[model samples]
Target: MAAAIMNLVRVSDPDTIVLGGGVAGSANFVERIRSYLNPKTMRFVSSARS
Candidate 1:
C-alpha cells in the first residue's frame, strides 16, 4: 500500500499527499506508511494536519 502511494507520489509529484479516510487517520498506520516512504521519496513532510 505504501509502495503504491509512493508510486503515485512519484508519478504525480504533488506538493503534498493528503491522506484521508479512517485508516490514514490512525497513528500507527501513518507511521507504517511513513516508514517505507521516508528518506527516499518524501524528503520533507510539513505535517499531516493543516
Candidate 2:
C-alpha cells in the first residue's frame, strides 16, 4: 500500500510515521498515505497517524 509506505520512507528516514493494525484503522487511511507521499519525500516528514 502506497508503495509499501514509500519503501519504508526510503529506508527509515523517519521523523514520525505511526500506523497500527486493521489496515491502519480504515477511514481515509492516513489521508491515503498522505496523498501518496513524495512531495519531495514530504519535506522532513511530519507526523502520520492511524
Which is the leading candidate under TM-score?
A: 1
Clashing pairs in 2: none
Scored by Cα lDDT, where does model 2 land? 0.73
Each model's lDDT? 0.74, 0.73
Q: Write the per-residue lDDT of candidate 1 for residues 1-50, one digit (tens) a residue.
A: 78887788778877877888998879998888777876745665555542
RMSD value for candidate 1: 2.5
> Please, what is the TM-score per model?
0.69, 0.28
* Highest-lDDT candidate: 1
What is the TM-score (0 to 1) of candidate 1? 0.69
Error of 2 at 14 (Å): 9.2
TM-score of 2: 0.28
